[model samples]
Target chain A: MSRWGRRPQLSFPDVGSIEGPLLEVVDLHTSFRTGRGLVRAVDGVSFNLARGHTLGVVGESGSGKTVLSRSIMGLVPGTNVERSGTVRLSGHDITAMSLDELREVWGMQIALVFQDPMTALNPVVRIGRQITESLRLRAGLDRKAAYETSVALLKSVGIPAPEQRLRNYPHELSGGMRQRVMIAIALACGPKLLLADEPTTGLDVTVQAQILDLLAAQQRERHMGMILVTHDLGVVANRTDDIVVMYAGRVVEQAPTAELFARTRMPYTEALLRSIPRLAEASHTRLRAIPGRPPDLATELKGCRFAPRCPYAQDHCRKEEPPLRAAGQGHLFRCWYPVGSAEGDAALAYNVAARVPAALAFTGIPVRDAALVAPNAVGSA
Target chain B: MLRFIATRLVQLVVICFLISVFAFLLVHLLPGDPTLAILGPNDTPAARAVLLHQLGLNKGLVSQYGTWIMNIFHGNLGASFLTKQTVTNALGVAVPIDLELVVVSQVLALLVAIPMALIAALRPNRLFDRIATTSTFAMLSLPTFVAGPLLVLVFAVTLKWVPATGFDRLSQGLGQNLKSVILPSVALAIGSVTVYYRLLRADLIATLQEDFVTMARSKGLSTRYILMRHVMRPSSFSLLAGAGISIGTLFTGAFVVEVLFQLPGIGYQLVQAIYSRDYLVVQGMALVAAVAFVVVNFGVDFLLTILDPRVRRA
Candidate 1:
């Protein structure tokens, strides 16, 4: 309405006063109808992020972590894609909103930082336009205001020479700088929720830490809810308030970040943590890899999705599935023999005595008890 | 950028030289003689031999080419063996019609095809997409020979909207000139519209799947805005290249349309010269058309660099 009258002012209403979590996702399932069959990428995943809190969704490729974030934004749209379930932003049901209605919500109520900054920003457009689009359109800022706010947004994201950077295209900037511009664009409208899907996936280790720290700092400064999706457990270990571990399209375990790391229950989660190279480890320490590939989600899974590779998996785990059940305060896991518990310890010992290959390989007991078992204990392993 | 343009210009000069050589050889290698086409069957051998000597045709092929090319550098294209008219003078009368037809048809084709492509790409495989694609195929299948007469029959014979077959001078009112141009341009443009639409729509659909498009969508940009601002430029690479190729090879399409509608164009001149075996005129027309082809493609290449910054650096 400044100078040239148009549509009325439009932006995410400040819903900071609402009583519940900033965002809630209930039993979201996303599947693609491919030539082979229905590939369920995200299945029955549920989580919540309160105001100013960061929720990390950690999983490997094809585990539906990226799909989960897109689903929350209602970004998955196609004839071949079938998405169902509920996603609420500040108590408004996003899943039920029409695409047109969701358009109003996107970038205003919630914005997403993409996985790869290299391909996220438009190659032909200047960084100024990319960062200030939401400001001018949704926030109804004037041309001058949008430009000024964009410079500030860039500066807030730790970019130097903001004015010069604003005029540059995506290809002009380095990988880390492009990612910073992406973060600036995401935070431009002061969205109530930010979905960052592996924001540092293609960056080097040092740049990865810088981007992660930058996102965390912005999340704190704006007090916006965030869902950080990544495969590396170490990336989210210190940044997130809560963590959700997805395996084969389902949320296998989720808990408050510190609590979950302190008492890791799910074997998949434990294996993911072990894979991260630790500083205290001696040079050339062999990283522990979870022995098998993630199961193909197109097939019907009748038991625990992690059972085939679990070191302590028993008959119960092979035949029956476990729900996401709580063990302690705010800690949830899905396992027949939860990691570090008495039942899990007993199961591990029994497997070692019975000479289970996975159990032997996991515990490093093969070298110690090599004479106790036959030489060829593992086929694939 | 300067170096790139300079390189392309060099390539164009080499291409023009090759095309001239090719045109000259094409006429010279023919079984018939040019003087026979000029002096007629009743002319005596002495008259034809004198004409051949005067024209320098009795010289070796290399010397003949060298003399012809040297004259071209001196701004002479020789003369038609039949009409005794300079090729440049003939081309001056004909080049305008062909250039206007090509320009109008290209403009018309893009004007219609771009919007259609943009719309069809939005919901590909749906009802609107299906209709547009089906119509594109139908238009593509209809050759200029068929489409030209069909347009003439419908627009001229029945509706009397335009002349059935004829050329009009631009000195006549602009409206009168356009009236005659309508049928031939439409006939020439319809085929290219289909080709360009299909190419552009496919590229747009592919670009729409790119991650940056999704990022643009998540920014709350309208579908149309995203399609135009975020999607269209990158998607138009193939379309621009196709346009370049079409403009370069335009004589083939124009030939059919001009003959069908009786328009004065380079293609028509080439056809008539070939029928009479007027070798100098035929070679001159071919050389002119080839130069146009090379220049058009060169401009399009420059445009491609302008549209895609990555291309300039590369």
Candidate 2:
């Protein structure tokens, strides 16, 4: 009955009660039916995020972090994609919602800041029009009001001469500026949840930091739940409240950020943590790369996905897949011998003695340097 | 933008000049002589020589070309060898028909192609997409020559719905003019629609996969709205380029369709001029067609600059 005419109102059942988590995803599975085979992009991932809390989903490329974020947003590409499981926002089931129904949820309740801001914005559209479109459509703001809000949003995102920038196209902006515009568009409607899928992936380091700080600051000011998806652990190290480590389209580990780093359990997470190049380390240090490529999702696997690359891998690890099990308070890991356990230590020691070259190969480093770097790596773990 | 337009205008002029030279030389290179065609073979050598001298055929090729170029600048396209009528006067009568045919067909083709392409792209690999793809291929394979007769048989001969051949000027009743032009226009349009349908469909499929489209989808824009606004514009670049080149083919197609329908268009005149070896008419038509090609391409470049920010900024 408003300006758009006869749109179905998207009213939540209980708007007043805010007891449960703001977002809850349970047993999510998203697969693609490619010509080769069925590729399980996000194989059985589940996590919950509370209001105003930040959750970081970390993984290597092809580990399904992006897919997982998209799956939550119900934006999986292609009709061939097969998705199952519940995506609940504030106790309301959205997994079964039609696109028309989901339209109400998107932009108003949830929004996404995509990776590769270079290509994430429509090149032909003016920046102001792009930002104001959702405002007019979803928020039902008048043209003048939307324009004013768009200018304010751009200004809030730290763009200079917001009035003039509104007229410029995406190609006219720098990469970092484009990313800021993307953030501004995502934040325009003031959604309760913001999914940032590697928001700073292609920005320069200084710009990356600035963009991340801007996002964190905005999230805090708006008190919005955020899911920060990034392959770089350092981006989420101090920013997120909780972290989910994905491997081969599955959640290998999930823990509170401080707890995960202080007492790392999964060997894959430990390897990922070790792989980060620290500035405090002496210059000219060869980075310890995680050996072996991520497993092909099209092919079925019987054991833990990380077993092939784990130095602490045992015969039992090769025989059976490990279920996500609770290791400690607010921490879960998918490993038979969790790190720092007696069995894990004995396994590492035995592997080091029996197959020193194999142990060195696991870290993708020289044998002599492996021993020299092991102490410094384990001390951090 | 002004500088870009100026550069393009300069380039267009250069292209048209080269095309004029080529058309002039190619027409003159024909096996039979225009003078011989005009005068019977039994004509005396003295008479033929006098005619040749008068027509300036005895002059050097360069001198003849220089005179033709100078005449062109003075707005004289020369007189047809057979009819002895000014080529510009004939063109004045014929060019409008060809323009109407081309413009109507292109408009019809776009009206059909854009929607079909969009529907196919939106539900790719589905029944609609499969049907559209197969039909476009079928239409593409069905040459204008064949499609023209088939349409004539169905609409004019079999159904007796409209006239099968001939054209009415727009000075005539608007409705009758449209009715007369519709069959030939449709005949020419079928081939163009097939090309545009395929090009737009392919580009839309690829553009719909772009991250910005995903971003738009994530923004809760309706599928229809996204396809129309965000997906259509960016996906149109390749289609626009293809359409610009297709204008040349449209002319060729128009020649065949015009002859089939006996429409009094430039294409019909062109075919008649070629068969009778009317050198001046052929040269005039060729120059006009070449100019149309260059102008169409120039327009496309300007449109691309406006549509694409990357090109605009560059």
Candidate 3:
């Protein structure tokens, strides 16, 4: 505990080895059969989330990050969806649950907070009613009890004047307030798992930070395992316990948060890190973006999904599919030529060293604490 | 909301007064003298003139219009030129029959159309949706006269289930009257249903794309719940709006159905009045129909405002 300010005591049980993962997505492949052809939105993706931990699924649009979240939530559209493999949430096979059975678990055991809070809410209904609709239906709460609980929910999500706010419509509330309301609704029944699909995607930067902070705090308080799907790598760095880097519908790399950044084995993961605008670096410097758009999911690719985009793709990468191999302890990467091989590691290390001076020359720090604080700053940047 | 009603009321009054003026002038300007119909051709010209003078038609057009307008203001549409019965008394028979016909047909249309639309939208591009679309298109294409006869042949002549022609008041016996009215109501409703189904289908498809539906599914709401709660409620306004806008067409269809079925409704009476060259009866009946169209449409507008808050706020 810190000596200065009081920290909210979180008496969460210590992270353990015996509990087994709360959620395990084993090689899930979900494809939609459209008129044009079969588009594999999520192809052979796999991940695991232990209890009370956060797994950040990070990728650009069309990388199947959002689709992964939806697949887990069992909310993919279209009747002709060809879904194979298992999404075991709390040890239940979600793919086999009937609609009624799914409803029984929806808000009570698992819930989703969608990207756009404004459009995600029903415009015609009152906020209070929308919050209570699931609670009352799933939890069998009476009208009085549901309504009273709804107020408490609004307050829990950090909305001021909960009673008055409940009377307001979705449009009447600000964007930030609407997002808070959405979180409140999702958490009303205290679900064990929360799937936030780009939760702060559309908000202003300031609001996005606040929302992320709130979500982090809430997840810790409730001891809820969260799967945060986002394109912003910076968001995952500070919040998530584990990171899954996906490229073109497949999980290319998975590792602990710090290791994924400090020792990115996959070229896609390396490119993604290089693409982020570091505050410790120079201003007005355009980011090092990954060349070429994501591979078309409709077409059958024989080799690595990222081969066309990967700068280090060998002739073998074009012919063979790279299986996810152990890169380090608790770290895996699906790359024929991993970023830290003898050939790439020397260049990568040299690049990291060269980047330090360039970064220092770029951001002239406001030097109050001297140069001793620079490494901590580098970890953040 | 009060202001909106007040404004609508003011407009209604102005519209009603204009209707009165038009009805009065059109009758006065009509080709045949109403007295000739009232008094048979055997009556002497002098006697006919005296009857006309008594009815105030012998006066100058301006004075005559003023007097007719005054009578209209005092709740008199003038006595029936031929029957000498108060037009109001004649209307008591005409209005209720027509009201029942219109109401019944609308109910039938709504009942049939909403379900057809939902089915079509739920399974779009499938055989059922294709069939419904084709059926509604066929119904829309057929004229009411043709439909009326075809229905009569099938249900009345072939099946021998209902009478082919003629109407009896429900006071005679609810069952008998309903049997008599059913064919005509069905005939009239087919057209309305065709239009309503098309509108509702379009609305349902659009409503399905709304974010609330995605939200509903994400919350694990069943397809049925999502359809009813999210898709149906939001789209119900479009159906009502369509119904409101097409009231004039429905009334016209009602007229054709009434005449075809030999129902003694306002449309039938108006036809008889027009054929007999009974100017007062024709003018009064036409004016009443116009008033009904206006009132029904206004009420529909008000209902739309209530159902869709956006319209009220606008």
Candidate 4:
């Protein structure tokens, strides 16, 4: 009989010998077959999340952060997309599992909090039904029991008038309330790992913090692994135990969150930190926007994907790609000359002196303004 | 909700009145003299005038319209000039047959359309989808008259499973009545099935891509469960609206099918009355059909508001 036939036994078996990481992703690659060419949405990425730890995935749009999360969850949309990787959740290699087998993992072992609360819910369904759905499906709870549990879950998510809210539709609730309901539903089955992809993207600034805090508190309470994917560095700064910064479908840098901020090695990571709009800055300060567009995934590139926009790119940087290497204890980055190293500084000075127009053209700043920004950037590096 | 329904009901009344007036004028404004047709074209002018005055046709158009409207309020639909039978009684005998045909055809169309559309939507661009699409297209291209005869030839003549070109009332044995309607219903339903299949397939495809469907999958709901609960309901809203308008068309198509099959339906009665210049019967049937269309559309609106909270809030 399948696992869902009986009441779930909470006692986990000791699968001996292969006592691996709680969640292990090895060299995951997800590519899509577009009309023009193959677009590598996620290429050669890997990470581990121990139980009770939060892994923050930081990247801009099209950085494959969303696809990486989906790939891990086995939720990638179409057969046209090719994926090769091993996603071992508590020793089972889920990468090769069919969709039917994946059902046992989803909700019971893993759950996801989608990005848009507005569209992430069935508009016609009541909030109570949405929350109770997983409870009934995964836990085999009866309708009344599931509904009561849903009410409790709503209360746990800090929703007021939980009973009333349960009867209301998604559109009847405010954005914050709907997001809280989404969280409630994600937690309904007591998942071992929760993948929250930009859980606060479209919400108001004030509500974003509340939702993030709620997720963090729930994670701590349940002691579940979490992968928080976001484009904003500030969101994961204090929330995540570790951070992985991706660029052009590959991880550019990975390190402990504090270490990543304090002694960042990748130029892209350093540039990202510099671009954050600090509240301490003087009023009306111009935010330093990143230069150039993200690399076109449809095209093949010869070298480091960021070289064209990197201020420290040498000729060799354009000819050869740099592999991810350890720069410091528990720190890994893909860069020929690590940021803050003497070689990196010298390369930046050489590129500046060479008057490389292509490298500077991406900044959209005049030469004089770039010259002014260069010293401060180099000093930070 | 009550207020909305009340307002719609008022509008329904106005619509029915307008339809009555249009039907009355259309019969009256025909090039041939209705009075002459009734009295015989060879009759003397004095005789024609006497017949016209006796029949109240000598009254002005406004007075005639007023009298017709007042009689409608009193449940009188005037009298057929040919048989002198009350139009209401003629309709009473015919309306049930048309209603049964329309209802049965619609039900049959939905039964075939929804599942096929859903299957086509499930794995779009696949073999099942392609076959369903092609077949529906072929079905759509075949008009009712052609399909009706073809059904007769296959089921009535070849297989001899059902009687050819006739209808049995439900007051008869249920099985016999169903057997009689099977061919006609299937023939009448082909076009609707094609339309509904296409509309629902498109909508279901779009609905399946919605984030809610992904969310349902994330909850570990079975594919069948997700399709039935999450995808089907929302996708069906458009199908329901389309079905509402198609009800009107179905009635029109039923006229051809009923006449072809020699069924004693409103369509048959209306066609026969028109050929024989039975103006009262034509007017009554036209008004009834128009009223049904309006009422059905109103019901669709009410159902939509119930199904979609957005429409309700609006």
Q: What DockQ do you compute for every candidate structure? A: 0.50, 0.67, 0.28, 0.61
lDDT (tens digit, per residue) of candidate 2 on A300-349: 88888888788887778877898899977889999987888888787777
Residues B1-314, candidate 4, lDDT per residue (tens digit)?
67777877898888888898898898887667777778887889999888888878889988988988798889999889988899999888777777778888999999999999989998899999999999999999999889999999998999999999777877888889889888888888999999999999999999989999988988878887788778888998989999999987555558888887888777788878888888878888888878888888999999988888776655
Q: Write the per-residue lDDT of candidate 2 for residues B18-128, one digit (tens) a residue.
A: 999999998878898777788978888999999999989899999999999899999999998878889999888787888888889889999999999999988898999
TM match of model 2 to true structure: 0.95
| Fnat scores for every prediction | 0.58, 0.73, 0.41, 0.62
lDDT of 3 by residue, A1-381 (tens): 212122223222333433678888998998989777899989998889988999999999999888788788787766788888898876678788776666656766678988999888887667887888777655658889999999988988889999999887687889999999999988988888999999999799999998999899999999999999999899999999999998889889999999999888998898788788889878886666665789888888889887666655555676788899987777999987688787555433432343433222222322233334332212210
lDDT, ranked from best to worst = 2, 1, 4, 3
How far residue A250's Cα lies from its native spot in candidate 4, in Å, is 0.3
User: What is the interface RMSD, in angstroms, for predicted model 3?
Assistant: 10.4
Instruction: Return the candidate ranking by DockQ, descending.
Output: 2, 4, 1, 3
Candidate scoring better on DockQ of 2 and 3 = 2
| Residue A255 shift from truth in candidate 1, angstroms | 1.1
Model 2: share of real contacts kept: 0.73
Clash pairs, model 3 backbone: none
Kindly report the docking quality category of candidate 3.
acceptable
Candidate 4 lDDT at A257 equals: 96
lDDT of residue B42 for candidate 3: 88
lDDT of 4 by residue, A186-240 (tens): 9998888999999999899999999999999999999889999999999999999
Model 1 DockQ class: medium
Best by DockQ: 2
- The chain B TM-scores of all candidates, as shown, are 0.96, 0.96, 0.91, 0.96
lDDT, model 3, position A166: 86
